[model samples]
Target: DDTPYDTQFCNWTVQSRFPSNQVTLGPWVNPTFLVGDFGLLRESFKNQEWGFQNWTTRRLQLTYNGLSWRDTAQVQFSMRRKAYWYTINIVIPSQIMWVMCYSSLYIRPDASPARVSLVVLSILTLITLSNRAFDMLPIVSEPVWITDYLFILNILCCAHLAQFILLHSALRAQDRRKKRKQQQQQQD
Candidate 1:
Protein backbone atom coordinates (compact mmCIF):
# COMPACT_ATOMS: atom_id res chain seq x y z
CA ASP A 1 0.00 0.00 0.00
CA ASP A 2 1.46 3.35 -1.17
CA THR A 3 0.16 6.91 -0.67
CA PRO A 4 1.07 10.04 -2.64
CA TYR A 5 4.26 11.81 -1.50
CA ASP A 6 4.43 9.66 1.60
CA THR A 7 4.54 5.98 0.72
CA GLN A 8 4.02 6.19 -3.05
CA PHE A 9 7.65 6.99 -3.87
CA CYS A 10 9.28 8.97 -1.07
CA ASN A 11 10.02 5.87 0.93
CA TRP A 12 10.21 3.49 -2.04
CA THR A 13 10.14 -0.30 -1.86
CA VAL A 14 9.59 -3.28 -4.17
CA GLN A 15 8.62 -6.95 -4.12
CA SER A 16 11.33 -8.13 -6.48
CA ARG A 17 10.96 -11.87 -5.93
CA PHE A 18 10.39 -12.65 -9.61
CA PRO A 19 9.71 -16.27 -10.58
CA SER A 20 11.99 -18.23 -12.92
CA ASN A 21 9.71 -17.94 -15.97
CA GLN A 22 9.47 -14.16 -15.59
CA VAL A 23 12.28 -11.71 -16.34
CA THR A 24 15.20 -11.95 -13.99
CA LEU A 25 15.33 -9.18 -11.43
CA GLY A 26 18.63 -7.34 -11.72
CA PRO A 27 18.36 -6.52 -8.06
CA TRP A 28 16.28 -3.68 -6.60
CA VAL A 29 17.49 -0.16 -7.19
CA ASN A 30 16.85 3.54 -6.51
CA PRO A 31 16.94 5.65 -9.70
CA THR A 32 18.63 9.03 -9.91
CA PHE A 33 18.69 11.30 -12.96
CA LEU A 34 20.06 14.71 -13.94
CA VAL A 35 17.92 16.63 -16.39
CA GLY A 36 19.03 19.88 -18.01
CA ASP A 37 18.31 21.92 -14.89
CA PHE A 38 16.91 19.49 -12.34
CA GLY A 39 18.17 16.33 -10.75
CA LEU A 40 15.49 13.69 -10.21
CA LEU A 41 15.60 11.02 -7.56
CA ARG A 42 13.63 7.81 -8.05
CA GLU A 43 13.21 4.26 -6.92
CA SER A 44 12.19 1.37 -9.14
CA PHE A 45 9.74 -1.38 -8.34
CA LYS A 46 8.16 -4.43 -9.86
CA ASN A 47 5.20 -4.02 -7.53
CA GLN A 48 3.75 -0.55 -8.11
CA GLU A 49 0.27 0.48 -6.95
CA TRP A 50 -2.84 -0.40 -8.95
CA GLY A 51 -3.42 1.68 -12.13
CA PHE A 52 0.30 2.54 -12.19
CA GLN A 53 2.74 1.31 -14.78
CA ASN A 54 3.93 -2.19 -13.93
CA TRP A 55 7.67 -1.74 -14.46
CA THR A 56 8.39 1.93 -13.78
CA THR A 57 10.31 4.05 -11.34
CA ARG A 58 8.48 5.31 -8.26
CA ARG A 59 10.41 8.39 -7.07
CA LEU A 60 13.54 10.31 -8.03
CA GLN A 61 16.29 11.44 -5.65
CA LEU A 62 18.44 14.48 -6.50
CA THR A 63 21.60 13.58 -4.64
CA TYR A 64 24.44 11.34 -5.65
CA ASN A 65 24.89 8.31 -3.44
CA GLY A 66 26.98 5.19 -3.74
CA LEU A 67 25.13 2.24 -5.24
CA SER A 68 25.04 0.30 -2.02
CA TRP A 69 22.35 -1.01 0.28
CA ARG A 70 22.38 -2.35 3.78
CA ASP A 71 19.77 -5.00 2.94
CA THR A 72 18.71 -6.94 -0.19
CA ALA A 73 15.71 -4.60 -0.68
CA GLN A 74 17.42 -1.67 -2.32
CA VAL A 75 20.63 -0.41 -3.95
CA GLN A 76 21.26 3.30 -4.39
CA PHE A 77 22.18 3.85 -8.04
CA SER A 78 23.61 6.80 -9.91
CA MET A 79 24.40 7.65 -13.54
CA ARG A 80 25.53 10.88 -15.18
CA ARG A 81 22.97 12.24 -17.64
CA LYS A 82 25.57 14.42 -19.36
CA ALA A 83 27.78 11.39 -19.81
CA TYR A 84 25.04 9.37 -21.51
CA TRP A 85 21.65 11.01 -22.23
CA TYR A 86 22.70 14.40 -23.60
CA THR A 87 25.49 12.83 -25.65
CA ILE A 88 22.98 10.51 -27.30
CA ASN A 89 20.68 13.40 -28.19
CA ILE A 90 23.41 15.10 -30.18
CA VAL A 91 24.32 11.91 -32.03
CA ILE A 92 20.69 11.04 -32.83
CA PRO A 93 19.87 14.40 -34.42
CA SER A 94 23.13 14.46 -36.39
CA GLN A 95 22.39 11.03 -37.86
CA ILE A 96 18.90 11.98 -39.05
CA MET A 97 20.13 15.07 -40.90
CA TRP A 98 22.87 13.07 -42.58
CA VAL A 99 20.55 10.37 -43.98
CA MET A 100 17.81 12.70 -45.21
CA CYS A 101 20.04 15.08 -47.14
CA TYR A 102 22.63 12.59 -48.43
CA SER A 103 20.03 10.17 -49.83
CA SER A 104 19.04 12.75 -52.43
CA LEU A 105 22.40 14.40 -52.97
CA TYR A 106 24.16 11.11 -53.64
CA ILE A 107 22.08 10.69 -56.78
CA ARG A 108 23.36 13.83 -58.48
CA PRO A 109 24.99 13.17 -61.87
CA ASP A 110 27.71 15.77 -61.49
CA ALA A 111 28.94 14.50 -58.12
CA SER A 112 31.77 11.98 -57.93
CA PRO A 113 30.12 8.58 -57.70
CA ALA A 114 32.85 7.15 -55.50
CA ARG A 115 32.73 9.99 -53.02
CA VAL A 116 28.94 9.96 -53.00
CA SER A 117 28.86 6.24 -52.32
CA LEU A 118 31.35 6.54 -49.48
CA VAL A 119 29.44 9.38 -47.88
CA VAL A 120 26.14 7.53 -48.17
CA LEU A 121 27.56 4.33 -46.75
CA SER A 122 29.31 6.11 -43.88
CA ILE A 123 26.14 7.94 -42.91
CA LEU A 124 24.03 4.81 -43.19
CA THR A 125 26.41 3.11 -40.81
CA LEU A 126 26.11 5.93 -38.31
CA ILE A 127 22.31 5.81 -38.58
CA THR A 128 22.37 2.11 -37.82
CA LEU A 129 24.69 2.60 -34.87
CA SER A 130 22.52 5.32 -33.38
CA ASN A 131 19.41 3.18 -33.87
CA ARG A 132 21.01 0.40 -31.90
CA ALA A 133 22.09 2.84 -29.21
CA PHE A 134 18.51 4.05 -28.77
CA ASP A 135 17.04 0.56 -28.84
CA MET A 136 15.45 1.23 -25.47
CA LEU A 137 13.64 4.45 -26.25
CA PRO A 138 11.18 5.72 -23.64
CA ILE A 139 8.69 6.48 -26.41
CA VAL A 140 7.34 4.20 -29.11
CA SER A 141 9.23 3.73 -32.35
CA GLU A 142 8.21 6.18 -35.07
CA PRO A 143 9.36 7.56 -38.44
CA VAL A 144 11.49 10.06 -36.60
CA TRP A 145 14.35 8.66 -34.53
CA ILE A 146 18.03 9.00 -33.73
CA THR A 147 18.81 6.99 -36.84
CA ASP A 148 16.61 9.28 -38.90
CA TYR A 149 18.57 12.29 -37.75
CA LEU A 150 21.87 10.82 -38.90
CA PHE A 151 20.33 9.87 -42.21
CA ILE A 152 19.25 13.46 -42.84
CA LEU A 153 22.65 14.88 -41.89
CA ASN A 154 24.39 12.63 -44.37
CA ILE A 155 21.96 13.72 -47.07
CA LEU A 156 22.67 17.38 -46.41
CA CYS A 157 26.41 16.85 -46.67
CA CYS A 158 25.96 15.03 -49.95
CA ALA A 159 23.81 17.83 -51.33
CA HIS A 160 26.44 20.41 -50.49
CA LEU A 161 29.17 18.30 -52.11
CA ALA A 162 27.03 17.78 -55.21
CA GLN A 163 26.44 21.51 -55.56
CA PHE A 164 30.15 22.19 -55.36
CA ILE A 165 30.93 19.49 -57.91
CA LEU A 166 28.32 20.80 -60.31
CA LEU A 167 29.74 24.28 -60.07
CA HIS A 168 33.28 23.02 -60.62
CA SER A 169 32.31 21.02 -63.70
CA ALA A 170 30.42 23.93 -65.24
CA LEU A 171 33.32 26.29 -64.69
CA ARG A 172 35.75 23.75 -66.19
CA ALA A 173 33.61 23.37 -69.30
CA GLN A 174 33.34 27.13 -69.71
CA ASP A 175 37.14 27.47 -69.46
CA ARG A 176 37.62 24.85 -72.16
CA ARG A 177 35.23 26.69 -74.48
CA LYS A 178 37.08 29.96 -73.95
CA LYS A 179 40.42 28.29 -74.79
CA ARG A 180 38.95 26.75 -77.99
CA LYS A 181 37.74 30.19 -79.14
CA GLN A 182 41.16 31.65 -78.50
CA GLN A 183 42.85 28.91 -80.60
CA GLN A 184 40.36 29.42 -83.43
CA GLN A 185 41.01 33.15 -83.40
CA GLN A 186 44.76 32.60 -83.56
CA GLN A 187 44.44 30.21 -86.51
CA ASP A 188 42.14 32.60 -88.34
Candidate 2:
Protein backbone atom coordinates (compact mmCIF):
# COMPACT_ATOMS: atom_id res chain seq x y z
CA ASP A 1 0.00 0.00 0.00
CA ASP A 2 2.98 2.32 -0.48
CA THR A 3 1.69 5.02 -2.79
CA PRO A 4 4.39 7.35 -4.05
CA TYR A 5 3.48 10.99 -3.65
CA ASP A 6 1.87 12.44 -6.79
CA THR A 7 1.83 9.16 -8.71
CA GLN A 8 -0.87 7.53 -10.77
CA PHE A 9 -2.09 3.99 -9.79
CA CYS A 10 -4.14 1.11 -11.23
CA ASN A 11 -5.21 -2.51 -10.46
CA TRP A 12 -7.38 -5.28 -12.02
CA THR A 13 -7.73 -9.02 -12.70
CA VAL A 14 -9.27 -11.55 -15.12
CA GLN A 15 -11.05 -14.89 -14.65
CA SER A 16 -11.26 -17.78 -17.11
CA ARG A 17 -12.09 -21.51 -17.06
CA PHE A 18 -12.00 -22.67 -20.71
CA PRO A 19 -14.06 -21.09 -23.49
CA SER A 20 -17.15 -23.13 -22.43
CA ASN A 21 -17.67 -21.04 -19.26
CA GLN A 22 -17.20 -17.72 -21.02
CA VAL A 23 -20.85 -17.52 -22.11
CA THR A 24 -22.09 -17.99 -18.54
CA LEU A 25 -19.42 -15.92 -16.84
CA GLY A 26 -19.31 -12.71 -18.83
CA PRO A 27 -20.93 -10.75 -21.60
CA TRP A 28 -22.54 -9.35 -18.49
CA VAL A 29 -24.81 -6.43 -18.93
CA ASN A 30 -25.07 -3.41 -16.66
CA PRO A 31 -27.83 -3.81 -14.10
CA THR A 32 -30.91 -1.74 -14.88
CA PHE A 33 -30.99 -0.40 -11.29
CA LEU A 34 -28.35 0.54 -8.76
CA VAL A 35 -28.67 -0.39 -5.09
CA GLY A 36 -28.98 3.17 -3.76
CA ASP A 37 -28.36 6.86 -4.39
CA PHE A 38 -24.68 6.03 -4.84
CA GLY A 39 -24.43 8.86 -7.36
CA LEU A 40 -25.05 11.31 -4.51
CA LEU A 41 -22.33 9.56 -2.47
CA ARG A 42 -19.97 9.80 -5.42
CA GLU A 43 -20.47 13.56 -5.49
CA SER A 44 -19.29 13.74 -1.90
CA PHE A 45 -16.10 11.84 -2.75
CA LYS A 46 -15.34 14.38 -5.47
CA ASN A 47 -15.41 17.25 -2.99
CA GLN A 48 -11.91 16.48 -1.72
CA GLU A 49 -8.70 17.96 -3.23
CA TRP A 50 -8.23 15.02 -5.56
CA GLY A 51 -8.53 14.44 -9.30
CA PHE A 52 -9.53 10.92 -10.40
CA GLN A 53 -9.47 9.10 -13.71
CA ASN A 54 -11.53 5.87 -13.91
CA TRP A 55 -10.67 3.48 -16.75
CA THR A 56 -11.17 -0.13 -17.86
CA THR A 57 -9.37 -2.26 -20.49
CA ARG A 58 -9.98 -5.84 -21.55
CA ARG A 59 -8.30 -8.27 -24.01
CA LEU A 60 -8.51 -11.90 -25.18
CA GLN A 61 -5.72 -14.00 -26.72
CA LEU A 62 -4.94 -17.61 -27.78
CA THR A 63 -1.47 -19.14 -28.24
CA TYR A 64 0.29 -22.51 -28.56
CA ASN A 65 3.80 -22.91 -27.22
CA GLY A 66 5.93 -26.01 -27.92
CA LEU A 67 5.08 -27.38 -24.48
CA SER A 68 1.47 -26.30 -24.02
CA TRP A 69 -1.59 -24.39 -25.28
CA ARG A 70 -2.64 -21.13 -23.61
CA ASP A 71 -5.83 -19.10 -23.78
CA THR A 72 -6.07 -15.87 -21.88
CA ALA A 73 -8.56 -13.14 -21.12
CA GLN A 74 -7.54 -10.04 -19.21
CA VAL A 75 -9.46 -7.19 -17.62
CA GLN A 76 -7.92 -4.12 -16.12
CA PHE A 77 -9.54 -1.46 -14.00
CA SER A 78 -7.53 1.64 -13.23
CA MET A 79 -8.09 4.66 -11.02
CA ARG A 80 -5.72 7.62 -10.83
CA ARG A 81 -5.77 10.07 -7.91
CA LYS A 82 -3.72 13.23 -7.37
CA ALA A 83 -3.65 15.27 -4.15
CA TYR A 84 -3.54 19.11 -4.20
CA TRP A 85 -2.05 19.81 -0.77
CA TYR A 86 1.51 20.23 -2.03
CA THR A 87 0.49 22.73 -4.70
CA ILE A 88 -1.73 24.81 -2.43
CA ASN A 89 0.35 24.89 0.75
CA ILE A 90 3.93 24.24 -0.22
CA VAL A 91 4.47 25.62 -3.73
CA ILE A 92 2.56 28.86 -3.37
CA PRO A 93 4.23 29.82 -0.10
CA SER A 94 7.70 28.95 -1.36
CA GLN A 95 7.17 31.16 -4.40
CA ILE A 96 6.00 34.06 -2.24
CA MET A 97 8.95 33.61 0.11
CA TRP A 98 11.37 33.59 -2.80
CA VAL A 99 10.00 36.90 -4.00
CA MET A 100 10.27 38.37 -0.52
CA CYS A 101 13.86 37.21 -0.17
CA TYR A 102 14.83 38.84 -3.47
CA SER A 103 13.04 42.06 -2.58
CA SER A 104 15.10 42.42 0.64
CA LEU A 105 18.18 42.96 -1.52
CA TYR A 106 16.89 46.47 -2.36
CA ILE A 107 16.82 47.70 1.29
CA ARG A 108 19.48 50.37 2.00
CA PRO A 109 22.70 48.64 3.00
CA ASP A 110 23.42 51.36 5.66
CA ALA A 111 20.48 50.07 7.64
CA SER A 112 22.69 47.23 8.86
CA PRO A 113 20.69 46.51 11.99
CA ALA A 114 17.40 46.19 10.18
CA ARG A 115 18.94 44.13 7.37
CA VAL A 116 20.62 41.75 9.82
CA SER A 117 17.47 41.22 11.82
CA LEU A 118 15.30 40.62 8.78
CA VAL A 119 17.77 38.11 7.33
CA VAL A 120 17.93 36.23 10.61
CA LEU A 121 14.15 36.04 10.79
CA SER A 122 13.94 34.90 7.17
CA ILE A 123 16.43 32.09 7.81
CA LEU A 124 14.44 30.90 10.81
CA THR A 125 11.15 30.98 8.91
CA LEU A 126 12.64 29.00 6.03
CA ILE A 127 13.98 26.39 8.42
CA THR A 128 10.62 25.89 10.04
CA LEU A 129 8.93 25.58 6.65
CA SER A 130 11.52 23.04 5.44
CA ASN A 131 10.86 20.91 8.50
CA ARG A 132 7.16 21.05 7.78
CA ALA A 133 7.77 19.92 4.21
CA PHE A 134 9.84 16.98 5.43
CA ASP A 135 7.08 15.95 7.81
CA MET A 136 4.45 16.11 5.10
CA LEU A 137 6.31 13.92 2.59
CA PRO A 138 7.15 10.22 2.76
CA ILE A 139 10.78 9.68 3.72
CA VAL A 140 12.78 9.18 0.54
CA SER A 141 16.38 9.52 -0.66
CA GLU A 142 15.78 12.37 -3.11
CA PRO A 143 14.35 15.75 -2.10
CA VAL A 144 10.95 16.84 -3.27
CA TRP A 145 10.30 20.05 -5.22
CA ILE A 146 9.32 22.03 -2.14
CA THR A 147 12.41 20.85 -0.27
CA ASP A 148 14.67 22.02 -3.10
CA TYR A 149 12.91 25.36 -3.25
CA LEU A 150 13.41 25.90 0.47
CA PHE A 151 17.11 25.06 0.23
CA ILE A 152 17.57 27.65 -2.49
CA LEU A 153 15.66 30.20 -0.46
CA ASN A 154 17.98 29.60 2.50
CA ILE A 155 21.02 30.18 0.30
CA LEU A 156 19.56 33.46 -0.88
CA CYS A 157 18.99 34.58 2.69
CA CYS A 158 22.58 33.80 3.61
CA ALA A 159 23.80 35.71 0.56
CA HIS A 160 21.79 38.73 1.64
CA LEU A 161 23.34 38.56 5.10
CA ALA A 162 26.83 38.36 3.61
CA GLN A 163 26.16 41.41 1.47
CA PHE A 164 25.05 43.32 4.55
CA ILE A 165 28.28 42.47 6.36
CA LEU A 166 30.38 43.53 3.36
CA LEU A 167 28.53 46.83 3.09
CA HIS A 168 29.09 47.48 6.79
CA SER A 169 32.85 47.01 6.35
CA ALA A 170 33.02 49.40 3.36
CA LEU A 171 31.04 52.10 5.23
CA ARG A 172 33.31 51.74 8.29
CA ALA A 173 36.38 52.22 6.07
CA GLN A 174 34.91 55.42 4.62
CA ASP A 175 34.23 56.80 8.10
CA ARG A 176 37.84 56.15 9.20
CA ARG A 177 39.22 57.82 6.06
CA LYS A 178 37.11 60.93 6.71
CA LYS A 179 38.34 61.13 10.32
CA ARG A 180 42.02 60.96 9.18
CA LYS A 181 41.41 63.74 6.64
CA GLN A 182 39.86 66.01 9.31
CA GLN A 183 42.79 65.45 11.72
CA GLN A 184 45.38 66.27 9.02
CA GLN A 185 43.56 69.52 8.14
CA GLN A 186 43.44 70.63 11.82
CA GLN A 187 47.23 69.98 12.29
CA ASP A 188 47.97 72.17 9.18
Candidate 3:
Protein backbone atom coordinates (compact mmCIF):
# COMPACT_ATOMS: atom_id res chain seq x y z
CA ASP A 1 0.00 0.00 0.00
CA ASP A 2 1.15 3.53 -0.77
CA THR A 3 2.12 5.75 2.12
CA PRO A 4 -0.77 7.95 3.40
CA TYR A 5 -0.14 11.67 3.18
CA ASP A 6 -2.65 12.57 5.92
CA THR A 7 -2.36 9.72 8.41
CA GLN A 8 -3.03 10.37 12.10
CA PHE A 9 -0.16 8.99 14.12
CA CYS A 10 -1.27 10.10 17.63
CA ASN A 11 -3.88 8.40 19.87
CA TRP A 12 -5.73 10.04 22.79
CA THR A 13 -6.43 7.99 25.91
CA VAL A 14 -7.43 8.96 29.45
CA GLN A 15 -5.00 8.09 32.22
CA SER A 16 -5.39 8.57 35.95
CA ARG A 17 -3.38 11.54 37.23
CA PHE A 18 -3.67 14.17 39.95
CA PRO A 19 -4.71 17.70 38.89
CA SER A 20 -2.23 20.54 39.35
CA ASN A 21 -3.08 24.14 40.16
CA GLN A 22 -0.89 27.15 39.26
CA VAL A 23 -1.40 30.74 38.21
CA THR A 24 0.74 33.67 36.98
CA LEU A 25 0.02 37.40 36.66
CA GLY A 26 1.82 40.59 35.79
CA PRO A 27 4.08 42.18 38.39
CA TRP A 28 2.54 44.45 41.04
CA VAL A 29 4.64 47.56 40.39
CA ASN A 30 5.19 49.20 36.99
CA PRO A 31 8.75 49.29 35.72
CA THR A 32 10.72 52.48 36.27
CA PHE A 33 12.25 54.30 33.30
CA LEU A 34 15.57 56.11 33.11
CA VAL A 35 17.17 57.74 30.07
CA GLY A 36 20.95 57.83 29.55
CA ASP A 37 23.45 58.69 26.81
CA PHE A 38 27.09 58.08 25.84
CA GLY A 39 29.49 58.35 22.94
CA LEU A 40 32.50 56.85 21.06
CA LEU A 41 35.50 59.01 20.29
CA ARG A 42 37.68 58.73 17.19
CA GLU A 43 40.83 60.90 17.22
CA SER A 44 42.38 62.19 14.04
CA PHE A 45 45.36 64.47 14.45
CA LYS A 46 48.53 65.49 12.61
CA ASN A 47 52.05 64.93 13.92
CA GLN A 48 52.33 68.51 15.25
CA GLU A 49 49.67 70.54 13.52
CA TRP A 50 47.45 72.76 15.65
CA GLY A 51 45.41 73.17 12.48
CA PHE A 52 44.41 69.54 12.81
CA GLN A 53 41.18 68.63 14.54
CA ASN A 54 41.28 66.58 17.68
CA TRP A 55 38.85 63.69 18.30
CA THR A 56 35.19 62.92 17.65
CA THR A 57 32.57 61.00 19.58
CA ARG A 58 29.33 59.15 18.88
CA ARG A 59 26.49 59.02 21.38
CA LEU A 60 25.21 55.61 22.53
CA GLN A 61 23.08 54.00 25.17
CA LEU A 62 23.38 51.79 28.25
CA THR A 63 20.51 49.58 29.31
CA TYR A 64 19.74 48.11 32.73
CA ASN A 65 17.53 45.27 33.71
CA GLY A 66 14.38 47.16 34.70
CA LEU A 67 13.44 47.85 38.28
CA SER A 68 11.65 44.74 39.56
CA TRP A 69 12.82 42.10 41.96
CA ARG A 70 11.32 39.50 44.27
CA ASP A 71 12.35 39.69 47.89
CA THR A 72 13.52 36.50 49.61
CA ALA A 73 10.60 36.71 52.04
CA GLN A 74 8.07 36.79 49.19
CA VAL A 75 9.60 33.80 47.41
CA GLN A 76 6.95 31.44 48.80
CA PHE A 77 3.97 33.37 47.44
CA SER A 78 3.08 36.38 45.27
CA MET A 79 4.93 36.27 41.98
CA ARG A 80 7.47 38.92 41.02
CA ARG A 81 10.22 39.30 38.41
CA LYS A 82 13.34 41.35 37.80
CA ALA A 83 12.70 44.25 35.45
CA TYR A 84 14.77 44.87 32.30
CA TRP A 85 15.40 47.65 29.77
CA TYR A 86 17.64 48.41 26.78
CA THR A 87 18.63 51.23 24.46
CA ILE A 88 15.75 51.94 22.17
CA ASN A 89 16.50 51.47 18.44
CA ILE A 90 19.91 50.01 19.17
CA VAL A 91 19.97 48.09 15.91
CA ILE A 92 20.22 51.27 13.84
CA PRO A 93 23.48 52.47 15.38
CA SER A 94 24.82 48.94 15.46
CA GLN A 95 24.23 48.48 11.76
CA ILE A 96 25.87 51.80 11.03
CA MET A 97 28.95 50.79 12.98
CA TRP A 98 29.16 47.49 11.13
CA VAL A 99 28.85 49.28 7.82
CA MET A 100 31.63 51.73 8.69
CA CYS A 101 34.16 48.90 8.63
CA TYR A 102 34.07 48.83 4.85
CA SER A 103 36.45 51.80 4.92
CA SER A 104 39.35 49.57 6.05
CA LEU A 105 39.91 48.41 2.48
CA TYR A 106 40.91 51.94 1.54
CA ILE A 107 44.02 51.78 3.68
CA ARG A 108 47.32 50.90 1.96
CA PRO A 109 49.25 47.74 2.81
CA ASP A 110 52.46 49.48 3.93
CA ALA A 111 51.30 49.18 7.50
CA SER A 112 51.83 45.88 9.26
CA PRO A 113 48.85 43.57 9.25
CA ALA A 114 49.81 41.97 12.56
CA ARG A 115 49.69 45.35 14.25
CA VAL A 116 46.70 46.65 12.37
CA SER A 117 44.88 43.40 12.83
CA LEU A 118 45.43 43.60 16.55
CA VAL A 119 44.12 47.14 16.63
CA VAL A 120 41.14 46.18 14.55
CA LEU A 121 40.55 43.23 16.80
CA SER A 122 41.00 45.47 19.76
CA ILE A 123 38.38 47.84 18.45
CA LEU A 124 36.09 44.92 17.83
CA THR A 125 36.84 43.51 21.25
CA LEU A 126 36.30 46.87 22.87
CA ILE A 127 32.98 47.12 21.18
CA THR A 128 32.10 43.64 22.34
CA LEU A 129 33.15 44.36 25.91
CA SER A 130 31.36 47.64 25.85
CA ASN A 131 28.29 45.89 24.56
CA ARG A 132 28.49 43.32 27.34
CA ALA A 133 29.04 46.04 29.83
CA PHE A 134 26.10 47.95 28.44
CA ASP A 135 24.02 44.83 28.70
CA MET A 136 25.00 44.31 32.31
CA LEU A 137 24.84 47.99 33.14
CA PRO A 138 22.55 48.74 36.07
CA ILE A 139 20.10 51.58 36.45
CA VAL A 140 22.54 53.55 38.56
CA SER A 141 25.93 53.54 36.83
CA GLU A 142 27.95 55.97 34.75
CA PRO A 143 26.58 58.93 32.84
CA VAL A 144 27.68 57.55 29.47
CA TRP A 145 26.42 54.32 27.89
CA ILE A 146 27.33 51.83 25.16
CA THR A 147 25.02 50.76 22.34
CA ASP A 148 25.61 49.09 18.97
CA TYR A 149 28.89 47.85 20.38
CA LEU A 150 28.46 44.33 19.08
CA PHE A 151 27.59 45.46 15.59
CA ILE A 152 30.61 47.71 15.46
CA LEU A 153 32.70 44.86 16.81
CA ASN A 154 31.53 42.64 14.02
CA ILE A 155 32.52 45.23 11.44
CA LEU A 156 35.90 45.82 13.05
CA CYS A 157 36.57 42.11 13.01
CA CYS A 158 35.82 41.96 9.32
CA ALA A 159 37.89 45.06 8.61
CA HIS A 160 40.79 43.77 10.68
CA LEU A 161 40.89 40.64 8.56
CA ALA A 162 40.53 42.69 5.41
CA GLN A 163 43.48 44.85 6.36
CA PHE A 164 45.59 41.76 6.97
CA ILE A 165 44.59 40.34 3.65
CA LEU A 166 45.29 43.62 1.93
CA LEU A 167 48.70 43.83 3.48
CA HIS A 168 49.50 40.30 2.39
CA SER A 169 48.24 41.06 -1.07
CA ALA A 170 50.32 44.20 -1.32
CA LEU A 171 53.36 42.39 -0.08
CA ARG A 172 52.88 39.77 -2.76
CA ALA A 173 52.46 42.44 -5.39
CA GLN A 174 55.63 44.21 -4.36
CA ASP A 175 57.51 40.96 -4.37
CA ARG A 176 56.32 40.23 -7.91
CA ARG A 177 57.29 43.73 -9.00
CA LYS A 178 60.76 43.34 -7.57
CA LYS A 179 61.23 39.96 -9.20
CA ARG A 180 60.18 41.35 -12.56
CA LYS A 181 62.52 44.31 -12.22
CA GLN A 182 65.42 42.03 -11.37
CA GLN A 183 64.73 39.80 -14.39
CA GLN A 184 64.57 42.80 -16.72
CA GLN A 185 67.83 44.20 -15.41
CA GLN A 186 69.55 40.88 -15.85
CA GLN A 187 68.36 40.63 -19.46
CA ASP A 188 69.60 44.15 -20.15
Specify the highest-TM-score model's number.
2
lDDT tens digits, residue span 150-177, model 3: 5446656666676677778888899999
Per-residue CA lDDT of model 2 for 110-150, tens digit only, reads: 87766777778878778887888888777777656668777
Name the runs in model 1 displaced over 4 angstroms: 1-141
State which candidate, 2 or 3, has the greater TM-score.
Answer: 2
Candidate numbers sorted by TM-score from highest down? 2, 1, 3
Better of 1 and 2 by lDDT: 2
Better of 1 and 3 by TM-score: 1
Q: Name model 3 segments beyond 4 Å from true.
A: 1-85, 88-100, 111-123, 130-156
Q: lDDT of model 2 at residue 81?
A: 36
Candidates sorted on lDDT, descending: 2, 1, 3
Q: Give each model's whole-structure lDDT.
A: 0.45, 0.60, 0.41
lDDT by residue for model 1 (9-124), tens: 23233332322222223433333332112222223322222222222333223322454222222223332122244345556456554555455444544556655565666656
Off by over 4 Å in 2: 1-5, 14-49, 59-83
Model 2 residue 91 distance off true place after TM-score fit, in angstroms? 2.1
Estimate the lDDT of model 1: 0.45
